[model samples]
Target: MRFEIIGNIINIETIAVGSSIREVERLRKTYGSGRWRKLKGTGTIQLDDGTICEAELHWYEAHGIGKKEIKIKFILSE
Candidate 1:
């Protein structure tokens, strides 16, 4: 699913780090190496259909590689 983050992500937390990440090797191959981390946070996002929603977002990040493979893990219903 595709979505654009609207603003800052609150409640940020680390889900995994380094070898703990299942796709650590793949991430290094694809995005280059660093201290890789899997993290999740709650933020506002705009969906492809132009609908805005609050959601829990997950993604991989490294010191210089930035965020990659962002996903919406859960949506908060109105």
Candidate 2:
């Protein structure tokens, strides 16, 4: 999965195909530390069925504008 911390929001832009939810949670834990709190708001996840899954992702980091990008990934079960 591709993770990007844009401005004050932690963006999990491109989660690779077959990636597991645990991986996402790990990424959340990795980034959800120090001056970072999970962003509590509306978000969407597109499933393989082409159906958009609406949910809130608890992941974010407290930083200044145009912060550095953070990326991580994990293989998923087929």
User: What's each prediction's TM-score?
Assistant: 0.95, 0.32
For candidate 2, lDDT tens digit of each residue in 1-78? 333222332344423322333354554465542333333333444444554444434433444422223322221221
RMSD of every candidate to native, in Å, equals 0.8, 11.8
- The sequence of per-residue lDDT tens digits that candidate 1 reaches over residues 1-78 is 788999999999999999999999999998898999999999999998999999999999999779999999999852
Q: Pick the candidate with the highest TM-score.
A: 1
lDDT by candidate, in order shown: 0.93, 0.36
Q: lDDT at 40 for candidate 2?
A: 39
Q: How many clashing pairs per prediction, in order?
A: 0, 0
Candidate 1 accuracy as lDDT: 0.93
